[model samples]
Target chain A: MADPMKIRATASGDVCEIKVLMSHPMETGQRKESDGKIVPAHFIQTFTIAVNGKTVIDAGTGTSVSRNPVFGFKVKGPKAGDKVTVSWVDNLGDKRTDEATVA
Target chain B: MDATRRTLLRGMGSTGLLAAAIAAGVLKPTRVFAAEYNKVAFEAKDLAGGLKGIGAASPAESKDIVLSAPEIAENGAVVSVTVASKIPGTSALAVFVEKNPMPLSAHFQFLNGALPEARLNVKMSQTSLIKAVALANGKAYMAQKEVKVTMGGCGG
Candidate 1:
């Protein structure tokens, strides 16, 4: 549906963290096709990140954003070796989920 | 066949690409332009289903989350972007394209909320909007903006 996802994380002076990237066009539904048809606004309304099955970051969106977005956040109480799960949904009702561990 | 012609162009070099682009312009602009619609249409199901994995989130403005990108990009083909969230309960964070082929472009979920952040370069076919939704403390909050792509990045 969108694009392949990429994820990265690191230690900020002894603090471990992770980051992620997703592919999307992020249409605002206000544009038109070459033929002059209205393209409806379609974007991921919200997404979540979990570490060790616990919640850490929660966010949402509308049409006032750019496509192929990136999200960054940090979590403490974890070592260098831990897992993080990420997921999202779009305006057209599309969805994607991917996970990676912190290095 | 149209498929053959498209494949031939795909197989060709820059010269072929230019010639094909010219041919496409003369033959059918609407069909060529609508090709990206298939991308957005196709990613719909996967994006919708993926978002449902998490139930809810608690919203908070964490100085931990940092969004980095050019305030204005000369080209949208591969605009670099990065996000970082420094919070304890950040289980997952995701990015979305409001008007791309599929809305849910990518997602990052961790075994624990101990680490949540990411960086990537995404392709924008035209001037469009983008969004990022985060999950924390069982609630959700978000940010959004617009990006202008100078040329056609989505494959014609």
Candidate 2:
């Protein structure tokens, strides 16, 4: 099982700021170990964020991202008490889903 | 019983399960998943090639697209980048780091009137030009900024 993602959603006036921190290795497949073996490419391929079950952002990421990636966003429609869920699928078919209530 | 050995054992355990799944026909390996990773874009040496790899032909320079990043990155391994488009009807946003081994970092698609904004952390091999491209009404607009890296990222 993958580690749980950390998500925060704060509403200010009409916009809600959402921040996420994902725990991942984000290996680019280009790096080699001390034994001179190439590490296979293993990274998050797709990331999605939804508010109240409505999709807001769908992203495609590559190995170039840093380990334990952090993402932020601003949405207009969501208010306090709305459901905000963030999920990601990695290259190895591993999936993680976590959610936070809009504050 | 070191950390490296533990990690290796864990990796081997996952691989063993994957092999077992394949043998049991629980997971049918398909080309769809394999083709999802854009190898060409990641291998592109220049900005034009990277853009071409992602299917953005000629993006016009625009000030409406905001590329928020620090002028100096204290840590290149986790530099915060945020791209927001002020253009109406924006649909997509892509980020590229010109100096990294791979230029194309992340691509985002917005649907159902979602705001054209994305914030993510990227690794920079060194000081590089960070570019943001916004697709609005099928037209592409780009904005870029320079970020100096005090410490090298990307295994440099």
Candidate 3:
């Protein structure tokens, strides 16, 4: 199982700013271990953001992203009380989902 | 060591059983949380190949598409990037690091009321041109920035 993500959503003037921080190794496969063995690629491959049950952002990322990735996005029409959900799935099939209230 | 081997064998046994269940239709696999990852685009090795894989082989350069990145990065392992598209009807955005073994870094699809902007951190193998592409109204617009990396990110 993967660690839970940290999510923050804030609304101002009908627009919401959402930020996500995910935990993962984000191995690039080209990297070698201390023993000279190649590290297998392991990274978050897909993620999604939703506001009040409506999908807002769908994303696909490769191994070029840094470990423990952080992402930010903006959306319109979200209010202070709306639910903002963020989910991510990794190359190993591990996944985590977390949510925050628009503040 | 023998105990550890036994545990590993047990884990493998369970995995084989799980696969059998999936194949037998008893445990249907589900990918409800995420859409399919773009393997072809993410695996492209060069800028031109990445652009072609992402279906933006000849994107028009546009000032409205903003790609914000540091001019010099002390750590190539973590370079902050932000891309914003002011073009109307923009629906998707992608970032590419021209020198990485696989240049395509990320792709974002916006729907409903989502804005055409995104911020993330990426790895750069070395000094490279970073390109941001925005798909709008069935066309592609792009912006680029050169970031000098003090250290390479892809090697261990």
For each candidate, how many residue pairs have backbone atoms clashing (under 3 Å)? 83, 0, 0
- What would the DockQ be for model 3? 0.57
For TM-score, the strongest prediction is: 3
Model 2: per-residue Cα lDDT at residue B42: 59
Candidate 1 lDDT over A1-103, as tens digits, reads: 5665786756555566556777777665656888888876666655666666666655554343456666555666655566777776554435677877777
True contacts kept of 3: 0.78
Error of 2 at B138 (Å): 0.7
Using all chains and alpha carbons, the TM-scores for the candidates as numbered come to: 0.45, 0.82, 0.88
lDDT of each: 0.56, 0.81, 0.87
The candidates, ranked best first by TM-score, are: 3, 2, 1
Residue B119's lDDT in candidate 3: 99
TM-score-superior candidate, 1 or 2:
2
lDDT of 1 by residue, B20-130 (tens): 454355433233221111222234533343345333232444455666666666765566666555556666666655556545555555544345666556656557665
- Best of the candidates, DockQ: 3
TM-score winner, 1 or 3: 3
Report fnat for all candidates as fractions from 0 to 1: 0.19, 0.54, 0.78
Write candidate 3's Cα lDDT for B101-138 as tens digits. Answer: 99999999999899999999999999999999999988
For candidate 2, what is the total of clashing residue pairs? Answer: 0
What is the interface root-mean-square deviation of candidate 2? 3.7
Give candidate 1 regions above 4 Å deviation: A1-4, B1-156
